[model samples]
Target: MKIELAENYGFCFGVKRAIKIAEDNQNAATYGPLIHNSKEIARLEKDFKVGLTDDYKIFKAGDKAIVRTHGIQKQELQELKDKGVNVVDATCPYVTKPQEIAQEMSEKGYSVVIFGDDEHPEIKGVKSYATHGALVVTSPEELEGVKLHEKIALIAQTTRKVEDYMKVANYLIPRYKEVRVFNTICNATFENQDAVRKLSKKADIMLIIGGKNSSNTKQLFKISQENCQNSYHIEDEKDLDFSWFDNKNLCGISAGASTPDWIIQNVIDNIKSKIS
Candidate 1:
């Protein structure tokens, strides 16, 4: 059996920065899971005494609070500061860009259209920045029956595929008199997805490592499946099924931005042990 790895996988700049910030500021609690990977979060809790909390009210005066990489709503952040919580913001710069854009464009009288999951923390946070009405859609079909303004501003969750954003942009551009589109998908996401797409075509079996709830990891798995029928999404080494590798000449490994190198190495080692 042969092993292959995606050219760009695991520990994106934002995740790395968030983890380091949390680690350096011991006894601080993050606004949420600092990153999507539970393994890394658990490690931080155990080693650095970093904690996680979604409710800002729990943070008392003088308590250190770290904003997760996905960020929180603008109102929530303001409340944190008003409460006297010592905030160590770790919001990814990429995520911050869309939030700023949403606020700026919406204030300027543009209806905002964001292409991503509405329930995602990033999207929820971004929406808070919009002063005008905002629409979140997974597909262009969602725009049906909705009345959008003649002028529109478009952005996406940092991890969402640009192709989907493009689809939504195509729909609005023709219908609206003026449309401003910002390709807010992070560069790291594009590189990772492209790498997986290329690797899956050549590998017999594909392993996508990351948290089950991780949006970017799920996207990678979906992209891999498009090119390879045998693609599997795994959280860790324990999730690997030896049967999947049987008679496979090449197995490809790709991980989400939040996945740590240790987790990826364990998956690789476990695969080698099973195949040997």
Candidate 2:
């Protein structure tokens, strides 16, 4: 069997930027996982001595704290700064756009509507920027029967599928007098999703790589599964099941924005060895 990789898989600009920031601040602790990939985080900890802290209060005055790429709630960030922690913002520019939009739109008297999982860190951070509170929904169905203001402003999680975001926009545009829709989804997401959609159609087996908790990775897995029944989402080579490769003619591989090339290569190498 032959192995192939998606054209636009692994380590997006934001993840790369965050990694560099973490490397530069060796002794600093990130408030959350710097990125979704645990292996990469481990690599950072082992090599650079960067640490991860779930609680912001652990940092003392003058201690360095690197913000996660997903960002923290606006209040949390302010509190960190107020506590005199040397804060380094590593929030992805793409994620920051929605947070700014939510605040700006909300201040302008537009009801903010975020198309994303409310529980997601990015969404929680973005939603906090809305002065009057924002509505979070995963689908158009969730918006049903909910009362929205006459003027609405909509933004999406950076990693969410555009088609899903559109469904939410379409639902509001018809009902509201003025609906302002911002394309907060990043360019990397567009390219990655398109690449997976194309590759999965041709490969007999598909491996989507990234952290299990990664939203973008989950989206890639969903798209791959839609076209290839043999699609599997794996974090690394260890998760591979050789049984899935039986009689497979060609294996396609794709990784999420948060995934690093090293992990992807390891999975590929393992697959090649097993099938050989």
lDDT of each: 0.93, 0.93
Task: Residues 1-276, candidate 1: write the lDDT tens digits.
Answer: 788889999989998888889889999998888999889989999999999887888998899999999989999899989989999999999999999999999999999999999999999999999987588999999998899889999999999998888889998999999999998999999999999999999999999999999999999999999999999999999998898987889999999999999999999988888796
Give lDDT: candidate 1, residue 239: 96
Q: After superposition, how far is residue 137 of candidate 2 from its true place, in Å?
A: 0.9
Residues 225-251 of candidate 2 have per-residue lDDT tens digits of: 999999999999999999998888999
User: Candidate 1: misplaced stretches above 4 Å?
Assistant: none
Q: For candidate 2, what's the RMSD?
A: 0.8
Candidate 1 versus the native: TM-score?
0.98
Report how far residue 30 has shifted in candidate 2, in Å: 0.4
